[model samples]
Target: MVRAQVLHGRVLDAETQQPIPNAQVGVADNRLGTSTNDDGRFVLSIPPAYQAARLTVALLGYRSHTQALPPLPGPELRIELKISPAALGEVQVTGLVEGIVREAVARIPRNNPARATQLTGFYRESDNDTIGRPRYLVEGLLTVFKPDYRQPGDDGDVQIRQVRKVDLRPAGQAVRIDWAGGPFIAQFGDFVHRRAQFINPRHFRDYAYRLGPGSSYAGRAVYVVAFGPRKGNSRADCEGQLYIDQASYAFLGAEWHYTAGGLRRARHSGASSRQLRVAYQPYAGRWHLKTVWWQTQARLPIGPPLNYFGEFLTTAIDTAQVARPGYVERAQTHDVFLRTTVAYDSAFWAGQTTLLPPAALRQALLDQPRQQRADSLFRRRRTGADSSTVGPAARPTPRESGRLGFLGRLSFGAAVGLFPLAGAGGELAVRYTPAGSGFALRGTAAVATPGPALATSFDYQFVLTKTLALRLVTTWLHGQFEGEGWQLGANYQRNLRPGHRPLYGRAGLAYIRQTVAYPVGTFDNPDDALRVAGTKLGADRLSARLQTLTEAVLPTLGLGLELTHQFELVADAGYLLHLRTRAQLQLDEESGFFLTRSSATINLPNADVDLRVNNQPTATLPWQPQHWLLSVGLHYRLRP
Candidate 1:
């Protein structure tokens, strides 16, 4: 067992009394250490043997320090870190209008190139005309994990899959995004990089100025940057202010607005802004990025409105490879974004892969002794157990019970009948099951009319294993021309091939009642002569239907296709039933001939009609039909 002792201390700037968060402290020989917390307090758990020796303290933006311990040590030590002007690089440029990018870039040591991954965060405002006020807000977080490729011949080919999270919500509720897709990550990276390129250095050259007296961020320089389209360059989506730390020449933070625009005006034009404050400290003779706090706000014209505020905390840096013996380093980053009271956290850990060629890797493996290689490969396969063992280890099994489920069906159809007359019908049904129960409850509603009809229904289905189910249905229908109808039905269905192609065959018996009312016509009106015979009408029907429905999901593309057929038994059994029907009828009267005759109706029963609809259904039964649809289209996924 290893024994450890605690060492505690606080870090403060030598020139200013402000506490320095994210200061690194560690034992010289042992690996135990931690960065300063928000309050600048840190505790290092040193191994027992190292407690009696001196401890090293390092801050990224400040100079490093070492404090020797007293002969007999206590649990805590007090240390003061000094600011060295040379240790912290001098400010090469400072101003509000436009700082000198060349000067700032010059300060970064050529010996150790600074590299970082970029990400974008966006928010937008929403407009709701129906409510007379904005109703919802949408926020999104996008990250781009790009490796440094400053020179040619560097590894340029990279994998594009890297998505963080997306959150969308109304103004007050919490937001969340499911991070499962890859293409989204690439899109976000492209957006961020494109905006980065639009910010003109010339704008900063004019706007840059030194800090003014009485400014809260005084002593810290500022610059105003402008971003717009250039000749042959696409329009930029960003513009903002950049704040720099004069002492260390590091970017303290920036505030900017982003909008999507082009040479011609576009519908999407809005602003997203952010403020970032960053501080660095010197540790072990090297300056490292310490703490960075970022807050963002955005206004979008799409959907409802949206706003977001987030902050990131960067901790340790480890170098990947040691060029010289006894030297080692690596890098790590832990970041989190906050919105109101909720926070989402993510971490990234990466190291340099071996640069050896394939031939070298093969030679290295071959260099190992044959017996040793065999042992390494088969280590996990060797098991110590009785060869005759045939049963699993003793363990308690939880009771297995099937859950209650529901399936809903919505159907709609339209028909054109005799003489400028049309009929439309819709039906919606929902069925539910109870655990281990053989019966289910169903409800339904339906509507039918000469011109337009509406219907609704609720239903219940009791599922028996994978292939059998029982259903009960209740339906109500109303029509514009026809009065109303009510139906009660029960069905038994069996499903086959539930894996690839699902086939369900159902037979149901239903009792239906329909009623109609018509206005009486005056005897003098010859056009209304037929109405007198049917001043009031009613119909009662008993029907039975057998239906076969099949649906298949395209395994590779995530698409679905369905087919259904229904056989109806109505009226007298002797009458031939039509599977699908098409009918046309016309009526005309010839007054010049001194007689009136109605045209005969023609009916083609069970005729097929092709209709197109969305793959997903709407909330309402028989889901609403689309006004227009595009068929035979192709979709492509692009990544940056």
Candidate 2:
């Protein structure tokens, strides 16, 4: 085997000097190529046979660049490309916009290959959390068996060959979307081959076309036609430009994005924006899909918005004697590549022409070796005790339990809780525990009537028997109202069932410091009562903030129902201790309300009546200030 020379480079725009992402970089007329990443960086491995070949860089709407290959071990190459703006002069002068679009659509079968083709490509995708934090990254080498372009409704079959992924979300967080079939998004979004709404001749009446400046794609001058929903069409569709080869009417490339109205009409879509770009290259007298890029922004119901991206670069294509992937090797549409694992092979990666991941992901890839070593050590230490006597079934390994990943020991949940005092609210909970450890950390937040509540706790569990366990829980900074008081206490937890979905009972005592406040309307007849005492507090409403400290007993019951291996439904009911709620009335000059005052004056016929602090002024209510809480939620285990 001959060693390959490694090449590193960056692509930028000539005028703006800004990095150009998704720019095609490769050797022309061969099966060696890769696309630039979001940061405009790329790495290519050149075989000894291609040492004399010149490198080519191209992007839609940009002038293609070519340069001679530099010697091995050289500085990073910088290639800048100038924008090739589409000039509308010729297109406007012709005034045949719709005719051009219709002709292009009609020539699709003639321009594209009618025979089946096999394409082997490298695919990569990254997702960000609502706050733009990297959530996960997945990269895979896959093969696509593309049917004839004229075939109706056959998107193609994909088989993942080698795959690897990393989860970047913080531990104890849940990502509901598993991103199944992510790699095939580009193929499914092929508007040209699929005869998208705006491109189909039958739907031409539903769209209006305008002539645009023509640009070059893959060294061909293409006719740029802009199209959108027709006037009063009332259709949910997109607007974009189509790049059709002027000489052959072949659709070389197209870029389109969803409109705001389309996104609104897509119920439960959560997508605020979406865009896609695809380009085909002429090869062997036929136009073949060369590259595809797609991105979407989704607004989540909770937390931050999520951003998703996917890119596919065709490395090699075979049309002669092409074989389809076997049934066993074919991947299903619902398969999540990230859930499958493959050993990280540095040699394999070093030999493939692939896009370079971002800096953070690159570092994570480098750390894989260290993490594997740690996992091996942990397994040895844990299994050493019964290596000779223990059978596999008797002692389940961490891998069998799906507890080998970074977040294997964490669980997250979201719920709706109903409190007698706080009303209905939403709650989020997170729990983290190390493998083979009885100690865990838990944090929770709730939003309700009074205010949002936040609490953190430390728990230690003791296994008494095979079916029962005891847990000691200590919580602090637990409260219902912001800037109000907090609770610090300990609780005892007992499992009701073992070796099954969780069912438990809790009992404990806690000390709470709280401030209770009420509006003057809390009293039914305050004015009448004060008038009977000949003390008229001149105010329509009287409110007060009262502070107090109390000790309370807590009792709760909880249960869980397994939904999937990684998720469960959980419910709990609990009660807080009772206390006498109080408030002092005073007059506020700004709002004309009485609140928290020590003394007050009552206007009389001749003079004012002075009222001092006394126990007789207190009002006794018939209601208890205690609270009862019931919560139902979904919990997810981070491992699987």
Candidate 3:
């Protein structure tokens, strides 16, 4: 059993009475905390041991507040914080901004912890698609170890403890955001520690600074300094306000957004705009990172801009008895945090204080898109319990099994083959499935080579149980030869590797019908044959199309593996039992009937010709199809 006290409330400004979003709410003298959502609403879960501790609320440019809890499971409370009058007047006096900024930069080693510290926190990152719809969300409980503030180039390491991936895109759509090292954004965004960009003393000359009126953050009087690119400066296109504690020269917090010039420069790299906020709180003689919030736009050259939002709230900080994570435990700089394979822990998540998304965002995450709901109509639902059903009594229908929806079920595949047909070809396929039912129907139109044949197939699939399926398929081949084939097969499919991007395998065997056409003798053009042999011929060389129908029953074995979610990469191989075949042809003319008695040799390359007969190959013609197939391709699918 798990237990935690639930404290819920809203934070508002006392003077204007407006909701204060992103305000930090935590327990006094401890690390547990959460941030207010867009609407300034917050819910914090505290352990029973912290019942006697006061709740502390703080936001940049506002006075801090600490109050005792009213009661267990109490009513929602309101926290109103006010701006300091003295700080307001102080902003009007804009002098000494540069001096303060310089002093803060020099005092970083003194204000921040010089030794390594491990911080345990909650990290959440959500991204939207080109159309601004939610693409996906990732939340994790993380342990990060930071090097000393005095270290110049060492970025810290992160060990992911628990993570959950929520696929919110309307099914079947590919999310293109790299999203690698998302957690490092919080670690690397510490400008005071990294001393880069606007905060670095070396680049200070590139920016012009001004003092905004005074302000207070975390109950400390702070000097609000605003900085922008100086005239004729091209170092960086950044402009923002920074909060520096007046007494300790410590940075309280900062808010920054890209300038127009910066955006223009970023456009070259596919980013349109970027904004960031970093906040810190003083504790035990050193300032500890409290939270970092960031939002950015990635402007795709071909689609709507993608928007991303992320937050890292320091829930617990351990300055003493801190140790760095082992090398294998540390998250690499290129690793995608959301794709980590750690299992979800419901109890841990339930006990942690998580920042709730806005109501609209929450709804978007829970409900399917209208098109998706419409597609679900085609799915068959299970009725009363049936003992014959192979899977669980309560399993999602085939249509709902995959992370993607209706449009995602339609896919185009390409593969190379070595038997029957010996060239590469592509196929476009559409699949339909019933809700709660394991049955599915698929249709495909394909074109392949050696003979460059056009083919079509219809497939029926019944999932016998979770991870296993039986399929019956029929196909027709045309173009160079007219033929038909069929197969009865079953396959086993399951996630071989687990992560945000999953990998799966499919292996099956089938009783297959193999059809192959053998080449017959070439025919001469009627005009040329008449001139050369003094006889009218039944066919022209160029127009003479020959085909033979022969088939063999064989057992076929196949295997396939697919990786990733939206656009999947699949590799496949097939082996079939070989068989010897005989061919016979057909004729449509009296002349062709009489020509069987005559013998002639003809050269007909590039000749205009027509076929009066298409027959089985003579005994002298001897060529056979190979017995193996292999291919690699990219496509989408209704995951089973």
Candidate 4:
């Protein structure tokens, strides 16, 4: 058994940024939970078994907050709760559909099982090739602890009993999903915890509801409600079905996906197509999550004539309908996803109920990174060599470190591919810096408001050794209007006092020339303008400037207390001084230097919120347009 530690924290209001008293705190599952005193402070002891379980806090009139507990000797903990704007049955009840949803919300605490239980879940996830052939597959039996719904179901600890996978494609050609994300994507099916946005009564009128044909679940009739964004409201539309029990008005099951209006944003964010289906089972008169299936397809534009199509298929089934009376166990010591470092046990799986893949697929699976990640765990444990760096605990030395490590290494990290799909346009980025050298090469691929693009840069030890290097940059932006850049510069570099984060700093000067690029008011990156259709630029636009750049990166800062090896929450500070020698730059010429700051921000791992000041650059700019940029981009890491 692992050793347990005391987790202490404070809760505060999001709006007021002040302490919140009497807030409830607990382990993701209810091994033990508590309420904060008047000062919004509380302390809870973790049992040795659940060191890896999630920690969550909740209070009425506020949205619930949840996060995975960090590893031992974690940083100080603080939680912020946003004011819940739930309509709370305050909607205009002109129709039966809206009334039903309101009633369902009211009856949730009762119909929902807020008790201790365990689940024997049969889980399967797969990825299909461009032509729809199975390319990757994973099947497993998960023994998940079902926590109280009063908090979040994911608060429950889960352990894998038996697992297996299949991959039919070659390593270089195979489509891969970040397995670290696999632990939580399944949680999306728990609508109560995942889909908190659409439930608010205040937003009820935004959807037009219709009653579909009634259906039977476990011999009980369920009221089917079909809802979507109202007519003429294409951009904000969401289309889905709700399965409610007729007598209890209990939310038995739910199914939802975006409509055509939602597809525009979805397609560019990764998947060109997708769907979700979930079913709940009833036992002991209380509803339980039964099954969930989510399928998605994507065609990523790597380069010209290199369009890659990939498919994802996932299904889960729960067997332990409900817990026996007074069922209890220790808090989860380790989460199943990050633990379980053993290899494929043929005999063990042979006897268990598992979805076995074809022989070639199984052999192919052996070559995937996931297989390495799974096997890596116990190997490190056996050697007592655990690392708390950028990679997983069992990470091998093959991965790089420091700035070169950050730039050279290719890692498809811990990002939940299921989210950040809302309003982000599109993006793709990769940086390469070979080992044992002062030379670096960086590149970015993106589809802005425009169609597509490719950007790259090269640098060599120019002065003061590798600490000061000479660099050259170039870009090819393709959209409605094409653009290009050529720049030559020198850079000074230094590494920050080292810790868990490999912080670094750099200052540079360069001669730059660009055409059809965004002007001052927005961000400087030309790729920002590339959308699905493409970017547009006016003719005769030219820029010749002497540029000064200074920047610092603090990759260790984060808001949520989740123990993740990936760069979940990080911060970067930068300053760029562009002195226009040709045409006057907009904002830089207008008034002040461009300034920017963004934080508290554990929104999405791969997502970015750029705030460009007049002295600074936003995610986008108006070269000579009227305003600044507030850029939101969604990135899908197809490869390391």
lDDT of 4 by residue, 473-580 (tens): 343333332344445665555545333333335555556554333221222323222211122222122121111121221111112221232222222222223343
* Best of the two (1, 3) by lDDT: 3
Candidate 3 deviant stretches above 4 angstroms: 1-3, 15-17, 88-96, 130-132, 174-181, 260-268, 302-304, 340-348, 369-374, 378-640
True lDDT of residue 416, candidate 2: 57
Model 1 alpha-carbon miss at residue 89, Å: 11
| Best candidate (score: lDDT) | 3
lDDT of each: 0.31, 0.61, 0.63, 0.45
User: Over all chains combined, what TM-score does candidate 2 have?
Assistant: 0.55
lDDT of 3 by residue, 19-92 (tens): 88988888857467778888889888878878778888887667888898768788889999987544443334
Q: What is the Cα-based TM-score of model 3?
A: 0.57
Better of 2 and 4 by lDDT: 2
Highest-scoring model, TM-score: 3
Lowest summed lDDT across 10 adjacent residues in model 4 is found at: 413-422
- Poorest 10 consecutive residues of model 1 by lDDT? 325-334
Candidate 2 lDDT tens digits, 39-134: 789888888888888888888788888888899657898999998865533433354588888888778789887888888788877786654445
- Distance from true position, residue 17, model 1, in Å? 6.3
Off by more than 4 A, model 1: 3-6, 13-35, 44-64, 68-74, 82-99, 103-146, 149-274, 280-289, 296-309, 321-640
